[model samples]
Target: DRSARLPPYGKKRLKTCSFTFRNALLNIKEELQKAISTMTARATHSADVAANTSKNVAEKLDLALAIDKRISKLASQAIDYSSQLSGFDSGLATQMASFQEQMSQIKRELKEGLGRLEHVTANAESAGWYFNDCTC
Candidate 1:
């Protein structure tokens, strides 16, 4: 009703202004749609990249865990070998000590036997039974 009171020129100018305003609103809407589309595409790409990175990290983590397990197994084996070597060394030392004791005993017995042989030879010589004169 109030617009009906305007002069013809004013009405024409109002129509033109309304047209321009509508065009501006349409353009703004179009720009907003383009921005939304671009943002959605970027978001999708970021999500994909994140997923790939996560997968890579998981793989590396699995490999690290496997290596850790292997290292633990190797360490355990080393400990077992070290203990076995220690036991072997102890046994060898005991055996060596026993062998040395046996050698000492043998040497003492040999000396005693030599002394008895020397005494017997002296007694035989005093009786004039010469060993070098035996032909058999």
Candidate 2:
């Protein structure tokens, strides 16, 4: 009777060990699937970042070209403005010179007229007598 009881206990121990093995295998399979999915997500994210970086670089290059063109255009405009300003300065200088010449002529005429009037006044004061600088 004791020998029959030992066989049943041995069968029970065998069944328990098989169940534990199956559960462990299932856990391992689930963990491996999760790791594969994480890796795939990371790869896709990296690809998207690289593509965006290329697009940003292209946009920057185009903007730089546009800025260069604007700078060149502004430089041309500045040169034209300087040339016009020089012409205006030259014209102003010429006009100033002409005005100075006219003013000098007016001063000379005034001095001659003043001298003539003073001589006439002196002659009338002497009753039709004329006198001038003379040497004996």
Candidate 3:
């Protein structure tokens, strides 16, 4: 009855309007789908990038920890070597002092022996024990 009330030109115009509206709704739906797909792709790419960055950071952290451990070990070894060197220096100093004392004692003994030899030589010359006159 409503269609019968409309003029013949009005019915044709209504049909055209309906078709245009349907086409517009379809276009809107396609644009929404494209936007969702683009957003999903971007999200996936961002996730991959974030994962790689996290892995790199973890590897770098591990390397830093290993280096720290090595440095600590080296420091400990250096301390041990320093202690050994200190002990060696102390021992060397003590040995040098002992050697000096022994040298001093030897020097004193040599001087006393030289003096006794000089006295014996003078007594022998006064007693006429000349080397040339002795016929052995």
Instruction: Estimate, for each residue in 9-106, the C-alpha lDDT of model 3 and write its tens digit.
Output: 98998889999999999999999999999999999999999999999999999999999999999999999999999999999999999999999999
Candidate lDDT (C-alpha), each: 0.95, 0.86, 0.94
Sorted on TM-score, best first, the list reads 3, 1, 2
- What TM-score, computed on C-alpha atoms, does each candidate reach? 0.73, 0.58, 0.75
Q: Which has the higher TM-score value, candidate number 2 or candidate number 3?
A: 3
Clashing pairs in 3: none
How does candidate 2 score on lDDT? 0.86
Candidate 1 on 1-136: residue-level lDDT in tens?
Answer: 8679999898999999999999999999999999999999999999999999999999999999999999999999999999999999999999999999999999999999999999998988965655556665
State each model's C-alpha RMSD to the native. 4.0, 7.5, 3.5
Winner of 1 and 2 under lDDT:
1
The stretch of ten residues in a row with the least summed lDDT in candidate 2 is 127-136
RMSD in angstroms between candidate 3 and the native structure over all alpha carbons: 3.5
